[model samples]
Target chain A: MCQLLGMNSKNPADIGFSFAGFRARGGLTDDHVDGFGIAYFEPTGLRLYCDNRAAMDSPLAELVSQTRVKADNTIVHIRKSDDQLLSNAHPFTREIWGEAWVFSHNGKMTIKDAADSDPIKQGKSRHYCPVGDTDSEFAFCYLLNQLKEQFEYKPDARTLYEFLTVQCRFLANYGLFNCLMSNGEWMLGYANTLLFHVTRQTPFGSAALIDVDVTMDFETVNETDDVMTVLATTPLTSDEDWQQLAVDECIIFAEGHMVYQDVPTRPVYLSIEEGLKIAKNA
Target chain B: MCQLLGMNSKNPADIGFSFAGFRARGGLTDDHVDGFGIAYFEPTGLRLYCDNRAAMDSPLAELVSQTRVKADNTIVHIRKSDDQLLSNAHPFTREIWGEAWVFSHNGKMTIKDAADSDPIKQGKSRHYCPVGDTDSEFAFCYLLNQLKEQFEYKPDARTLYEFLTVQCRFLANYGLFNCLMSNGEWMLGYANTLLFHVTRQTPFGSAALIDVDVTMDFETVNETDDVMTVLATTPLTSDEDWQQLAVDECIIFAEGHMVYQDVPTRPVYLSIEEGLKIAKNA
Candidate 1:
């Protein structure tokens, strides 16, 4: 399994504080260190930084932490690769309709099985293809292909939210599918297992990091109108109220607010024996 | 007009020395600083760093100068944007046949006129499209599209060179067309106006930058077996014997050696009056 961190803000804000704690999960606090990547959506283009080196030790990541680079939308991933090639690094990006769409995944899914059912493999994804050999990239390409096939051009936000929720649920059925995706404007987060999020606004306070000996006073840095929402596979802060998402849920956030969410409507119970078999196979 | 710098080496090598001088052209030594970008091809993937800020002032560029990140192939550009959007920054990248193709251009051409004749604008470029509005990007899309239509997948290097030379000559007829392109394994450079390159081998010596007061002792840093070829809009070093490319010349470099070169077969003479009219119209 890997780790993910995403931020969406009404005003551009730096992720240095949370990234410091989250990057520790790459090797220091916990062991998911195969590679790491981060994507920051600038006003007119995207800046992507990725390395096969452990984030805990990467000089580039250190520079990122030291510099207060701000962005309205950002996504970061620390990977423990099932596919150990450098090409398998997270936060893969593809261009669509003149905008860069970025995606990162946190859990494993069976590649052969997913590709067998992917629309991209069925000959619909003529324009975009993955340059890496990871199941995560395959799934991302499939998702983009689906979107391209469904819409003639960029669709409205509500329509996109409705379509993507169903797609995420379908992907979750195959295996663990926690993911975060963005296209500069909005962030879409989906959870099959573990995900947590926190929205900070006017009543900002000091927060302590869970993985490092660090604390930040948000009140000192943020303005009254500043709204920022951060999502992660695990909570990075110890003192903040982070809401844990239920399984098989998809949420959309824009301008630091939850614009849309889809919760599981019907609960399906599985036998313990069946769950054990699924876990064993995975 | 913008500036382009490219490096192709036998072994993975850091471009910090040449980059320091080239970056000076971004604002300090010259005034081409609207934006800047660099793309480094790692063993299995590509790392792209770009910023709309002036390279002389960008902290990211400063960090790049400090870090010794190495690659076998690298391309850098400092721009005075005809279209001042971050998306219009040089060194744009697109993926084809599971390989990332990077390109940067250093001249201006009429946009609407070029688009009218571009295959991409004619709707035949189904596989690749420009995400940015610059004429350079449109030409890149057209080039990639023509390549795709001619070859089903990645073509042999020599075949690609032969095809690209003809295509570039066609583009140059419209206006100035100087560019550098790479797909990790090889680099292709085309010059319609000004471009220079130097290949360094065993008996390396200290060289001073033309744009900065810095000097590098290649003997101290490089192995005897190391070979590197650096190409730029102009000579980056003061003492090196850089070879200037003739008009309508295209060269291919791989593993630090020039594998192919094409020079114009016949030169067309134009009257001074006609030349002035063309320049004025452009």
Candidate 2:
């Protein structure tokens, strides 16, 4: 399993404060430290920084945590891989409909079961391909290939949301499929077992990091209309009210606001340990 | 217009010494400083860094130059753009056949003529699309789209080389189309006007930079069998004998050695000044 961290903002914002706490999970506060990756979507294009090293010790990660690289959308993952290959790092990216799509997954997926069910899902028949030997990257490629086959270009928000809702549930049927995906315009999260989100807006107060001893006063940092929504595998702050997303739920956020959400038709909530045990046995 | 720098090595090698001089052209030594990007293909994956700010002034560039990010293949570009948007920076990248393809161009291209010629090249009918409004990115998309349309999988090296020769010549018909492209296995260079390369093998000697007052002894840094071939828009070193490629020529280098070279059946060598004037007036 891996840890995911994501941010969506109404205006351009930096993830420096949040990243400080998140980076600690990679061999410091937690043990998901095989490799790590982060992609920040700037107006110019995507700024992706990845390393096949523990984030706690990587000099590149240190540089990223200290720098104020601002973006409207950001996705980050610290990996605990079954195989710690450099190409197996999380936050795989590809271009779709002329836009860069970024994806990161946190749980094992039974890709063989899914591929056997549909001919289009097979490797040779698919339009997108994974460069690495990870189920996460294979699933990302499969998702984009399906989207490309279904739509000639970017579709309406509602149509896209609906299509993704069905696909997310289908993927979760195989195993835990918690993930975050974005194309710089909008970010979406799917929680099969464990996920959480928190929105910060006007009348903001102070928050203390769960991993480190640092505290940030949002009142001093944010503007009157500034809005930000952050998503993670677990809550990063000790004091804030972090809402746990329901099992099999899919939520999309654009410009720091919830644009669309879908509830599972047949919700079957499972514990994180339960999901891990099944994945391991399979 | 832009300045491109590429390195293909037999073994993992750093471009810090070469890039020190190359980065100087991004703002300090020359005026091609609209933006800059560099992609280094490591064993695990590719590390891509791009900045809209001038490389001389950008802190990111400073860190990149100071770091020893070694790779077997590397592509770098510094732009002098007609539009300075961040998305327009090169070198551009896409994934094809589960492999990452990196590309950079140093001249203007008349994409309108090419798209008008074939329905397959048309935007609505293409498999790949450009996110930025640049002829270079459009050309890269068109090339990849055509390849995907013709071949279901990655073709053999000979077939690919033959196909690219024809396509490279077709693209050069529109305007100046000097470029460098690689899929991490091999690097190819097309010279319609200005491109130069230098190969260094055993008995490596000292060299001096043309842009900055810096000199380095390659003998002290390289192993006995170290082999590297460096390509750039112009000669990077003042002391070395750089070979200028013929007009309409395409050369493919793999593992620091020239694997294939194609000469135009009807060569028309044009000066750099002439190519610039035609691009401006078009």
Candidate 3:
């Protein structure tokens, strides 16, 4: 399978330290080296890069290191392809609703490829559009179409929340729908199967990578005041607080907590941090 | 590798329409058929489910379809593995920081034997405990430890932000680290290489998928006013606007706009509705 990495912080910071140990696994010290892709959110827009070759040997990645493409939001993937085509490459980028969006899938779909295509709209409802042959992309298109059809050129937060829950019901039917998405800030993530995150805030300290012997201190990096969230298909570290999502559950991670969960008769008011705590306990 | 599926919206619409097409790809439709897992975020916490077999073949999944386990947040994954070892699975689950966090990876991470069997830390910044022998878990451990060290348990937002970015950077250096993570309400995504997403709010419209002959009338199914976001390794739809993220960029997707970034200087800020036009003209 492939690996996934994500980060969302309150401020701008570099991903160099984390990448140090992560990159070693991509065909160098380890071997996820089939192909790789990455997406970073800049203040202006997004910066993305993908390579079909071993990431360890990619000179382009070297340039990326030098450029130090900084971003508060980022996604990364290393592929061991089952699709083996350029179209199947990850950290897929596209233009949606006049805004650029980036996405990446960490698992495989179970469909048998009956030459699937976007559904045909039958009424005034908006239709979803697909861009590629990958099932992951098809799911994305279907979701977009559903959103458009449901709203019909309208926008509302409350209504949107309800709509999101409804669509998640459908995604539950898909194979593995574990994914990460970003429009720059406030990263959104969902787990039908598995997804883990570590949110660190206040009281800086020291840490180290398990696979590599590299280490860093938060005190040295910044003013000992930082807020960040890191997500992965699996827990990146064994020491932090990782949260697992529930079946058929849809969450909206805003600011830095799992805020806006839709439950029947449940208290609708809670902070992001509180919601996150509640999710862990549940 | 594995596949992931997720949905976010303002309404409680079921993903059945899109899910139908997506599920087919899980095993019966496509061939991502290694294993299947799903999770949904609810007001209390999250509802999660998983099967060690193809989603299409998993009776549990079929039951789920008919049960309608709904939530505002959702995540899904399908595995394609050649090994029977439980460690070689997708959508791994775990508990962290007093919360339950699940994860799944699609690519391979080669942390290797002895090195992969490190002890996990329960709040220890210097330790990693791997339940499985996958490189993905190792990376997760490293990240968690790094967060601990970076913040040193300060619990400050700024410090947390810097730590994640720095961690992402360090991880990328090892291998492809693209991933998806969430608690319930919002999502945090990064593109170490490749990832795609779309934020759907009011003004819902029509769309189509390039992989299947499916179409969704979001206007009809939705509450006419909704907001949502979708992310993937690639663009899911064809006729919609999907944006690409820059390398090393990380974002916090909240409500519907990017609230946080890793870049030094961001462009002009715009509302959910106005940002599109502003970004377009810029």
Candidate 4:
């Protein structure tokens, strides 16, 4: 179990207020002291910070509070790995699609070994490859590789949306593969076990971290109409409304506002090429 | 041992050709293959991909080569660990001063235990918090912490320029800590044990990766100046005029060019706060 925090806004913004409370639940006040990380997308670059240490103890968390390294998009994670999961599956790792991709998850997943499920015959494989033996990270790489093989490097935005929805549905069947991803532009949130979100705009209100007493007056944080969406394994605030994510559901939030909502039907395993056909047909 | 590939250009460009050659050196054609990572500063944010596996075998590396993730600034490294540094002390990590800072390094480092060198209770205690347990990484956090303690946040470029040179000089004495750092605007490179660089611009010649034969005519590149600097633990190419760094010296490169150089009389041993004072004084 882990907690995830994300924000997408029209204008660059820091997630210190909401992250403050979310981090407490990971450890400190709560018991999530496994590891923590934060990613901020700046102009043509990113400020990504991670620590095998807890968020509360992370030098990054402290810096996030004091300094505003604003970004239009951001995702944060507080990991809680029980003995059931392998330590190798920690929320940070690199995945390959048509481009270098980064992924972090906040749930448990049991991925299949390709050798057992689908053995490679000779030198013939244009699909996914798993470098690490972790399930969650494997799922991320597998999903992305599927997308890559199907689209062959370029997929329209609409096609990407449908493909991702299908992939999310597929992941939901295997325990919690709840995830968040960014090519560093838009923030994608998928939930199976538990997750919540709140988007702030005009006439915003102050919110408190559920685990911590820290609160910030959103009204005083500039009068601009900025939309910020927050995601977590559980609600970080006692007072705010955190919409529970149904299995096979995903939401695309960009520039701090929700843009796409996907409630998938059922997940059926498909070949990488087959998945692309679905995208092309859709 | 590591291989670092960096590109700085007036316009965003795809680093596929150079990366292809550089990636091959990672435990394939040559040896430095313990881990590898590459980061791209796209038009809006950073797209980073890394793996603790051999770059030659990484699907992530293959994707990076096939898909052109164009960017203005990029850094890639293939690792062969000599110090047995843990992942926490690995080349990729973020440290903060005011703006978000990114750092990566090549080569081994001789880290002195503060407890070993500095007499305990022999003087008033100084405050220093290490974020990780590697000498290379410790130097990164220590430099930033020192700078932050003095300036708090947001210091000028000149101050930063001077401070980094002195700090690099100190860092170089502790064995091989050759490094590269960027704040998404300007880049700084310090050559300690062995690091080489090449800045390409108009009338550029055909440059090829030493590890692989992938080559491109810089003349065809769409940049006012195709300024690129390649730094590595060992010389990657035989043809290029690689500069051998002077022992115990630091060199500053900004905006595709070199601006300052420093050769310290002796290692500057000062408190974190005192070091920041130099940046402030500058």
Q: Distance (Å) between predicted and true CA of B132, model 3?
A: 44
Candidate with best DockQ: 2
Tens digit per residue, CA lDDT, model 4, B177-233: 668776666666776544556666666677666777666776786565456555444
Once fitted onto the true fold, the runs of candidate 2 whose alpha carbons sit more than 4 angstroms away are A112-120, A123-125, A265-282, B112-125, B266-282
* Cα displacement (Å) at residue A4, model 1: 0.5
Off by over 4 Å in 1: A82-85, A113-120, A267-282, B82-84, B113-120, B267-282
Steric overlap count per candidate: 0, 1, 302, 14
Q: What is the DockQ score of candidate 1, to 2 decimals? A: 0.51
TM-score of each: 0.90, 0.94, 0.44, 0.49
lDDT of 4 by residue, A100-187 (tens): 2456776666555344444221112233334334566567656755675676444776788778888777765665567887755677
**Candidate 2 lDDT for residue B9:** 94
Q: Write the per-residue lDDT of candidate 1 for residues A1-282, one digit (tens) a residue.
A: 788899999988899999999999989998778898999986676888887888998776887888888898999999886554567888998877667889999777865564655543674335566787887887888787788777767898889899998878777765778899999999999977777899999888989999999999999999999999999987899888998776788898999999998878763433425432443455
What ranges in model 4 sit over 4 Å off?
A: A82-100, A112-115, A118-132, A264-282, B1-282
Quickly count the clashes in candidate 2: 1
Give every candidate's TM-score on chain A: 0.92, 0.93, 0.78, 0.81
List lDDT for all candidates, in order: 0.82, 0.85, 0.56, 0.61
DockQ score of each predicted structure, in the order shown? 0.51, 0.62, 0.01, 0.02
Q: Which wins on TM-score, candidate 2 or candidate 3?
A: 2
